[model samples]
Target: MVAVLARFLVPLNSLLAAGGARVSAAAESGKARHPLHAMVAKELRLWVATPTYLMNTAVGPALALLAAVSAAVAGPQALASAANVPGVDHDALAGLVSAAFPWVLGLCVAMTPLSASSVSLEGSARWVAQTAPVPSAAIVRSKVAANLLVAVPASLVAGVIASLSLAGGPADAALMVAAPVSCGLLASCLGVLLDARRPRFDWASAYEPVKRSANVAICVGAGVAASFAGGGATLLAGPCAGIAASMAMAALSVLAWKAASRVSLQDR
Candidate 1:
């Protein structure tokens, strides 16, 4: 009976200590906002700086150039032939390119979440957040804003370059800018939620968001799907449909952020 009591008591003590730690951390967080805001900003800068460099300075423009060259060299007939083989109408090749813009937007969406929360989601860093003075919601909001800071412009620029270089339409360019902006906002919020809830702190694997993170896949997939759907609708009508679709996505994303903010602010 004495031995059994000792074993049970040890485990119970450990549990209580852990709970106390979490409670103390929560109390610390209610102390101030500036430090937390700074941390969030720092995380944002660290995350966005690298990707923004690679995408705006490297990949996005490169892809747009390739697409433009392909469109130019192959002309409509080549596109038409490819489309026919795929059973998707040749004219739709133009539509496909138009649709590709939104997918690029998705890439923008994926950046901040992948970068900002990767480190802090785990042990000590997580504790740091717990002790931050800012409301959890503000911290989350800062991260999302950081995503937009990079994504909105980067995606829009990608569209513009793709249009000018690839000979894409104005409408297509608009879709590119709008689609990614919405997707980026949504993805950023989701990333914070994931980080806070199921942090992959112990993960020992390489962190290639494009390859390893489920968030990346989801962000890109949603962006492409939205872009394509919007572009297809635009092809049937005019740019209005694509514009409307982009607007709708943005609206939904705002609602999502608001919902996420509420959750972040709730008592831990």
Candidate 2:
């Protein structure tokens, strides 16, 4: 995994040191948000150029969604034939989707060779982004944007699959769809914040930081706990649960980003 990711990981390190990371002083007064636009564009370009970077997140979720659909298709018939078999009832679907929510979303953002490792991925070359003539906030926001670009669409698809499988009332169905999206928000924020706060610059392989690093574990752990709480609420109170969970995630995400925004990449 590290070798594959290292092949295309941020080939822009040189450009970052050159001029791509540069921003005009008047950019803040302009509509473009200057350096932020440049930084985000650079990250987006990397993904477009190295589509393989996304495979880790994409492959797993695709498989999970396929399994959920297959279960939904064969669930009723199998239950009719073998009463002792595992159930795929609405409640079962709800719990399954809820529990799986953050794990799936974490694939896109928190469990990273990307966002969670964006800073550390720079390795000894961290000076590129740090020396750029832009606020560290611009760099931070760019990472967040890059993460969301993948997470939003991917989470929506997963949620829709869960929603179809659940086949519940409007609120429950909506909750199924909303669950992954909110979890992604929380995961992304925590991933970025934790990585920024404690980065691993010296690594023999990118895989080491991703698996051996504390950021990924903490971020994923928090996501699972928060998501389980939300899922438990759904089990206890159907209607208000999803809304409350989504709102709580959104609020915490903002706070996390706020903390992350204050981090100085140059120092890390």
| Local accuracy by lDDT, each model | 0.52, 0.63
lDDT of 1 by residue, 66-144 (tens): 4444555665456556656565666666555545545544443443344234433333346665666667777667656
Q: How high is each candidate's TM-score?
A: 0.61, 0.72
Instruction: Tally clashes: model 1.
Output: 6
Backbone clash count, each prediction separately: 6, 0
Candidate 2 lDDT (Cα, 0 to 1) = 0.63
Candidate 1's C-alpha runs over 4 A off are: 1-37, 45-92, 99-122, 165-170, 205-225, 265-268
Assess candidate 2 and give its TM-score to the true structure.
0.72
> Largest TM-score belongs to which candidate?
2
Q: Which candidate is the best by lDDT?
A: 2
Instruction: Provide the lowest-lDDT 10-residue window in model 2.
Output: 104-113
Clashing pairs in 2: none
Local lDDT at 220 for model 1: 45
Q: Return the lDDT, model 1, position 19.
A: 56
